[model samples]
Target: MNPRPTPSPFSPIAIGPLTLKNRFIKSATNEGMSAQGVPSKQLVKLHSALVAGGTAMTTVAYCAVSSDGRTLPNQLTFTQSSLPHFKALTDGVHQAGGLASAQITHGGCFTFIRERSTKRPLSASGGFNKIGLMSGMFLKQAMTEADMQQVVREFAQGARLARQAGFDAVEIHMGHGYLLSQFISPMYNKRRDQYGGSLENRLRFPRQVLRAVLDAVGKDMAVICKYSVTEGVRAGNSAEDGAQIARMLEEEGAHLLVLSAGMNAESITTMFGSSFPKENRVQQKNKIIALAMAIQRRKEPTVEFRELYLLEHARKVRAAVKMPLAYLGGAKSLASIEKIMAEGFDLVAMGRVLLAENDYVNKLESGASRDSICTACNRCVAMMYTPGGTSCVLGQPGDAVLNSQQAASR
Candidate 1:
C-alpha cells in the first residue's frame, strides 16, 4: 500500500544530502541557556522539547569563531575547549530526530567591544553602532592585509571544529550587524583598501568565509548562510538594497539564505512589557538611560515593519538561484508558514514563536485545537536582547520554559 503524502509546510525538504521532517526551521535566537558556552542541561531540555514538537532542524544560535567576536558573554562560542560540550548538544538534538546546526560568527565592529581585550575584531568600517552608546571604534582591528587572511583561516578552522562536534550543518554567520555583515554593507565599510570600496571588494571577506566553510565542511554537511538583504533597513536602508545582498550571497554558494530586517529589540512605544520602558518616562536622574535609548532609536524614524511577508523577500532571492531558502522575523501561524511553502519557499524560520511554545510543532502535527502559541508581545526579544530577562511580557511567572532555562543556565 502507498503511504499518505505530507501536508504543505509539513512536507519534507531536501537540503543537501539530508531531508528535513518538516519545512519549519527553528531560527537562531540567543537562548541564554548555555553553561559557559557548553550545552547546559537547560538547553538540552529545551531543544528536546522543540524537536519532539517536530521542527525540521534547530540552529544553536551564534557560535562565535573568535572570542572577540562575541556580543554577549552568554553566547555559545564553538572552540576546541568547548568541543565536549558541543558534542553533547548535537547528540541531544539528533536524539530527538532533528538536524543540529551551529552558526559560527566573528562579530566584528557591531560586536559589543567590551567582550574581549585579546585581539580587536575584523570590520569593514571602524564605527560604533548608534544603539550602543559607549563611544569607541567598535572595529579596533579594522582588517589589514594580514587580518583578512587570518579571518579566512579562522572561519575554516571553526568549521572543522563544528564538524568534529557533530553538527549536521554549519551556518556561516554573515547577517545582522555582525562582522561579516559590516563587510557586506557599504554604509559600514568605508575604506579605500583592497577589501573595501566597491561591491565586489566589500563582499570579499564574506565570500571567503563561505568558500572556506564549504571546503571545510565538504559536500555532505549542509552549509547554510544567514544574511540580511540590507544592513540598516530600519535606519533608512531599502528593500532593493536587501535584494542586492541576497543576489551576492547566492553567488558565493550559499545553500540557504535568511532575511531579517529592523532591530530585534526596541525602545518600546507602549508597554505590555516592563523593559519596554514607558516611552516618555524620564526623571532627571534616569535621563541618561532614556537619552541613550532615544539616540539608538533617533535615526530610525519611519522604521515601519507592517506585517512583512519575509518569504516573499526570500522568493526574490530564489528568483535568482535554485538554492533552498528560509524566512525569519516572526512566522507566527501554521497557515502563514504553509502558504509560504506552497509558494516554493523551502522553510519558515521561527524564533520567538518557538521560544513561546515549545510544543508548537507538536500542536501543528497533532491537530491540537489551541490558541496561537505566539504572544506577539515581542517579549522574548525584550528578554533575550534586553539588559535582563526581568522584563519579559512572555515571562508569565513559573510556567515559561525560557525563564526555567535561564534559572538552570545560571
Candidate 2:
C-alpha cells in the first residue's frame, strides 16, 4: 500500500472536541485593549481582522481569573459584569469565520496594580516582589493553603466564564513568570512545603489548578496550555524540566500545549527576541526601576531574532509528549511555517507577524506574499503599555490613529 502524504499546514485539525479550519493560530500577545477590565471595541476588531485574514483561531490574551490577578489596571478580568463585552469580542471573531481562545492567567506577586485585591498578591513563597517595586509593594506573601484553594477556584470560574463568553477554547497561561510559572520555577519558588522544593512537588499546585480547569470546561471547550520550555535565567526551570511539565499536562487531560519560553520578570527578551528601543527605555515612569532594567539589559546576553527560535527547545518537549502541540515564537514566513509543520508541530502560533499584517495569512494562501515585513524591532513590546494596546509600529495605520486618539483622551 502507498503511504498517505503529510497534511498541509492549511488543512483542518482537531484539538480535543474542537476542530479548527486551519493550522494557523494567533498566539496570545497582550493587547492592552481593555480599560478598567472591560474589553474595548478595538479588542473585538483586532481578532475579527485576524480571523477574516485566515487565522484559524485568535487568542484573547491575559484575561485574568479575578480582579486581583490583573497585571495592569487595563487588563481584562473574567466576571459576570464583563460577559457582554467578551461575548461581543467572541461574536466578532466567529462572524469573521475564526475560533476564539481566551488566555486565562494571574499576575501573582508580579503585579503593579494591587488595590483591587483584598490582600497582597500571593506567590509560592514570600519574598521580594521586584515587579511590584514601582507600585510600592516591595514584598509578596506566600500562598497559604486557603489561598491556593481560592486560586484554584478562581481559575475554574474563569474557564467557565470564558465558555459563557463564547470562547471556543481556554488557553491556560502557565508560562512567562506568571502565577503558575512562579510555582514551577525553583528560582522563584523557595519553600519547604509540598508545593515547593523538588520539581515534582512544584508541579502539585499547578496540576491541581489544571485539573480544576479541565473539569470545569474540558468537555465543551478545548483546554490548551501555554508553558515555558525554559525560564532563560540562572537557577530557573530548564528545558528538561519543561518536558516533564508537558508530560504532566498531557496526563492531566490538556487538549493542546503551546510551547513558549522566558519569564516576563527576568528574561523577557528571550520570549520576544531583540532589545527594546532606547526611546522606550527613556519613557519608563519609574526612574529606579528604569535604571535597574538598564543594568539588567547590559548583563543579559543579546538574543537576535531568528526564524523558529524556540524550535530547539520545543523539539525536546515534542519528544516528551503525545498530545497535540502548538509552536510559538519567531515564525514569520511560509518557509518557517512549513518547517514547523515538518518538524511535527500540530499548529503554528504567530504573534508579531500577525500584528505586522493581519492579512498576511490570506496573502500567503493567495501567494501574494511569502514572508512578513516585520523586522522584530521589539517596538510592539513597549506598545503593550500604550493606550492603543500592542500593535506593529511599521504597518498598522488604524492602530496608529487609535493610539493618537487614546493618548489625546488620556
Candidate 3:
C-alpha cells in the first residue's frame, strides 16, 4: 500500500464541522473600517475582494465582546443594532464564495476608549496602563470575581452573535496582549488569585472563557483560537508556555489554533515585522505623548523580517499538540506556504501579503506568482489609525500626502 500523501497548500482541510475549500485563510488584521462600532461598506468590500481573489476564508479582526472591550471607538462591538451590519458583511463574503470568521476579543487595559459605565479598563491585575497613556488612561482596574464572570458570559454571547451574523467561524482572540492574553501572560497577569502564578493558574480564566465559547458555538461553527507562541518580552510567557497553553486550549475544545507571537503594546514588530512605520501623525497630536512613544519604540527589540520567521516556534507546538494548527506571521511566498504545509500546519494564514495582493492565493495556485510584492515596510500599521483604516500603501494612488508619507518613512 502507498503511504498517505502529504496535503498541498490548495488542498481542502477541516476545522471541526467546517471544511475550507483550500488551506489559505486570511489572518485577522484590524481594518479600521468600522463606522462607530458597526461594519462599514469598506469592510464588506475588503473581504469580498479577498473572497473573489480566492482566499478560502477571511477573518474580520477584533470584534469586541462588549462595548467596553473595544480598543477604539470605531472598532466593532457586538450589539443588537450592529447585527444587521455584520450580517451584511458576512452575506457579501458568502456571496463571493468564501467563508467568514469573526475574531472576538476584548481590549483589556489596552483600550484607547473608556466605557461610560466604567471609566477605567479592566484586566487580570490592576497596574499602570502604558498603552492607554496617550488617551489619558493611566491605570487599569483588576477584574473582580463578578467581572470575570461577566466577561466569560460576554465571550460566549459574542460567539452566539457571530453565528447569528452568519459567520462560519469565531476566532477567539487569546493572544496579542488582549484581555484573554492578559490572563495568559505573566507580564500582564500579576494576580495572587487562582487565575495567576503558575502556567495552569494563568490559563484558568482563558480556559474558562474558551470553554464558554465552545459551549456556545462549537457544534454550529468552527472555533479557532489565536495565541502567541511567545509574548516577545522578557517578563512574559515563553515559547514553551505557549505550547502548554495550546494543549490546554485543545483540551478546552478549540477546533483550530493559530500560532502567533508578540504583544501589541511591547513587541508588536515581532508579529508584524521589524520595519517600524516612519509616519507618526497620530502621535504628533500631543508632543509629550510623541516623545514617550519615541522612547518606548526605542526600547522595543528589533525583529527583522524573514520568510517563515515563526515556523521554528510553530514546529515546537505542532509536535506538542495533535489538533489542527494554522501558521501565521511572515508567510509570503508559495515556497514558504508549501514548506509550512509540509511541516504539518493545516492552514497558512496571511495578513500583509493578502493586503498587498488580494488575489495572491489564486495567483499561487495558477503559478502566476511565487512571491508577494509586499516589502513589509509596515506602513499599513500606521494606516490603521487613519479614517480609511489599514491598507497596503503599494496599491494606493500616488497622491501628494501618500507620496510624502512614503518619502518621510524612508
What's the lDDT for all of these models? Answer: 0.65, 0.85, 0.84
> What TM-score does prediction 3 earn?
0.92
Clash pairs for candidate 1: 229-242
Better of 1 and 2 by TM-score: 2
Each candidate structure's count of clashing pairs: 1, 0, 0
Judged by whole-model lDDT over C-alpha atoms, candidate 2 comes out at 0.85
Query: What ranking emerges by lDDT with the best candidate at the front?
Result: 2, 3, 1
Best by TM-score: 2
> lDDT (0-100) at residue 293 of candidate 3?
46
On a 0 to 100 scale, what is the lDDT of residue 47 in model 3?
Answer: 91
Ordering by TM-score = 2, 3, 1
Q: Candidate 2 regions off by >4 Å?
A: 1-5, 116-118, 283-296, 397-410
Please identify which of the two predictions, 1 or 3, would achieve the higher TM-score against the true structure. Answer: 3
Pairs with backbone N, CA or C atoms under 3 Å apart (clashes), candidate 3? none
lDDT by residue (tens digit), candidate 1, 1-410: 11223247777877876678888888877765665556566566666667877888898887888777676566677678888777777777888888888888877765554646545545675544543444344335567767777778888888889889988888887766677877766666778877787777877878888888887785878888887654434442355666666677777777787666543223232111112233332321234334545554553343333233354455566565556778675467666766566656677887767777767887887888334555555435435433332123553422234433432233
